[model samples]
Target: MTFSADYLLDRIRLKRRLRIWQGIGILAICAALLALAARFDVFGHGDHIARLWVEGIIRDDVARDEMIAELKRDPKVKAVIVRINSPGGSVVGGEALYRNLRDLANEKPVVAVMGEVAASAGYMTALAADYIVAREGTITGSIGVLMQSANVKGLMEKIGVKPVIIKSAPLKAAPNPMEDLTPQSRKATEAVILDMFDMFQSMVMERRNLSKAEVSRLADGRIYTGRQAKNARLIDETGSEAAALAWLKREKKVPSTLEVIDAIYGEEDLWAGAQSAIAKSFFDKTLISKGLSLDGLISVWQPELK
Candidate 1:
């Protein structure tokens, strides 16, 4: 009957689950209506601050880019706030997002509010914003780019299997995992990494207005706490979305009463609504089925197993 809070209790009473599902059904209905309203701009038509939730993995999203680009011309969108919560992803993904945000910033005020962890590419996205805020415990920075490859040459050799690679040039398939990494191939791969790192380094230097030496000192692929980041001049201050709004009101003169709308939640927000419903269903099936016995009554204290 007792278990961790973040995770569901190891054993759930069937009686409680019935009520939970009933409530989930109501939420599902409300979410649907909300999506329809958002799609049609039912509750949002006047001047407002657009909120872009940058969650999960960062990647090149053409549809999202197009939506953001449209904001550049949106007169009603008085300002934009980017809420970031990610551990970073591809270099090009971060670069494209940065450019798009910078373009938007040219026309309207843009602020970034970091969540739990916004490092690497996530940090790059924030750099494009006019101002940045984060929780005191948030993890920011980790300003670097990297490429990784795994080698199975030893495994292949042990299995008596050889790889036949045909390429136009030596550097074409430089880091093939099935083959030995020659000095030439290693040097070529390192060159690519260094070149990409230079791009990341330049972005930090130019966006933050820091000297090359200052950027080099901080961009050693290290993460800094929100407080440390402020002291290091990596971010403006440490706070939350409320702080971001206050800055906009003071500096950009954006009205605090303006309704905040989601920048990316348009016709496709139905999917987001459905995802919430589906997640609850998935959780019920996974937890209940695994924890139950043939008699539909099973209780064995196994916190580690759960």
Candidate 2:
């Protein structure tokens, strides 16, 4: 009987220790999850305004789309400010970002704050917002589409080198660098550019409430200052981000006390930044070698040289 009692006590003690350790493990996991949720702002602690920044060339849409989706899912995010600073890039990239922002605007008031240069597709992105604000000297409109190709046939001939291309159709590789663009190929390319240009123009006219004649007058691939854009009705106001926030508070009735959080998507940690920097160097070199070919139509601003 004594032996049995001793054995039972030992078992009880072991079970108690096991239960304590298991509880600690579960608590550790819960704490880890809570920390992660806090880091990601998953807990709705306070009302906040999301600031989604579009800087440099608008190349890829993945990060921006993810950020937009996150903001959309967050109930604490009452409004959004889209800050744009870019000369623009691929038409498809810009269009995708614009649509994502538009979708976000459906749930919250979205205002655009233009930085130094928001031309081409950058300006198109601003059109997705409820209102646009820009600095007086901010460069804004370059409403057009452009397609360019280099012909290296003469260079190859001079170098006694030729590139042979095999295609099922004559226009399969039309406007190739190894040959001069045929009249048919040029016409086909122009048609594609014009179609993209028309889409851009229509979006601008519809968003800015500009007449077709007004759009025709301004959409000649011309860059405009912020003041000029406002005068032309391309932008709503000539101001900075503060003006945008004020507009949100007064017009949209967003609370002035709400916290503004930058929700821009990209690398956040030092290790990630280092990795991205290394990768970006290679990617930039590739783009330069390929003449920045985005493999589709582009809405980019290239200033004409006299």
Give each model's clash number.
0, 0
Model 2: weakest 10-residue lDDT segment is: 274-283
Runs of candidate 2 with Cα error greater than 4 angstroms are 1-39, 42-45, 268-293, 304-306
How do the residues 1-306 of candidate 1 rate in per-residue lDDT, one tens digit apiece? Answer: 765864554345665888899998898878777666654577758998988878656777887798788788888889999999877767777888999999999999999999988988889899999999988898888887766567998998889998788889877766778777889998977787788788888888887889999999998888899999999999998998999999999999999999887764434456564453344235333534332221111111111343
State each model's C-alpha RMSD to the native.
11.1, 11.7
- Against the unseen true structure, what C-alpha lDDT does each candidate score? 0.79, 0.83
Residues 199-301 of candidate 2: C-alpha lDDT, one tens digit per residue: 9999898889999999999999999999999999999999888999999999999999888876635655543433333343343335443344566778887
* Local lDDT at 169 for model 2: 79
- Output the TM-score of candidate 2: 0.79
Residue pairs clashing in model 1 are none
Best by lDDT: 2
